[model samples]
Target: MDSADANIATELETRLSIIDTIERDDPSRRELSGADLSLFIGVSVVIVLFGILVLAL
Candidate 1:
């Protein structure tokens, strides 16, 4: 019973660590600063405008 408990604890710890790593690495998990958010929006607008211009031509 002790061995089985140890094995379960180890497995749970491993899984939790992996999940923590994945969450840390995930881009969407991050909060965007105001400057970063502004830059992203600006770039998106520019790209959309460029696409429209190209389509018009």
Candidate 2:
């Protein structure tokens, strides 16, 4: 194959390898308990309120 064709093949192989690595590292599923959900929402609300207060200043 030509130099350009070889470069393209190499690029494709690099990209596919990166994708495989990411898929392997990523979580398959997520599970949260009631307290975890509540805390997340509570923190989110507090952040939003703080942002609004800062903007009002």
Candidate 3:
């Protein structure tokens, strides 16, 4: 039973490592670009300002 459990754990780790490597290599999985970051920040600032305005009124 212990050996079986160990084998399962090892297999799981191996599969997870393969998945991680594939995901890292995938071109579609990209980090935020400069335009994306700017848009996000602009939207966030607008939302915050709107919230503050609502609270004031």
Candidate 4:
């Protein structure tokens, strides 16, 4: 269907834009900081805990 095709195209465009944004490192954009690191570590810990709980169950 035409609508489905359009939806696929839009999703592809969005993914491409995200990839481009990540690949292009502009100094004007905010750089990663300590808070980002802390958040990443916290999320990692949560994921590990959830995995352990699932295995225990």
Which candidate tops TM-score?
A: 3
Identify the runs in model 2 with alpha carbons over 4 angstroms from their true place: 1-30
**Backbone clashes in model 2, listed as residue pairs:** none
Worst 10 residues of 2 by lDDT: 22-31
Residue 37, candidate 2: C-alpha displacement in angstroms: 0.3
What lDDT score belongs to each candidate, Candidate 1 first? 0.90, 0.86, 0.90, 0.87
Report backbone clashes per prediction: 0, 0, 0, 0
How would you encode candidate 3's per-residue C-alpha lDDT over 1-57 as one tens digit per residue?
699999999999998887689777676667879999999999999999999999999
> How accurate locally is residue 17 in candidate 1, as Cα lDDT from 0 to 100?
91
Residue pairs in candidate 3 whose N, alpha carbon or C atoms collide under 3 angstroms: none
TM-score of 4: 0.46
Per-residue CA lDDT of model 2 for 1-57, tens digit only, reads 999999999999997887677655556534576998999999999999999999999
State the local distance difference test value for candidate 1: 0.90
Q: For residue 38, give model 3's deviation from the true position in Å.
A: 0.8
lDDT of 4 by residue, 1-57 (tens): 599999999999997897678745655555778999899999999999999999999
Model 1: colliding residue pairs:
none
Model 1 lDDT at residue 52: 100
Q: What is the lDDT of candidate 4?
A: 0.87
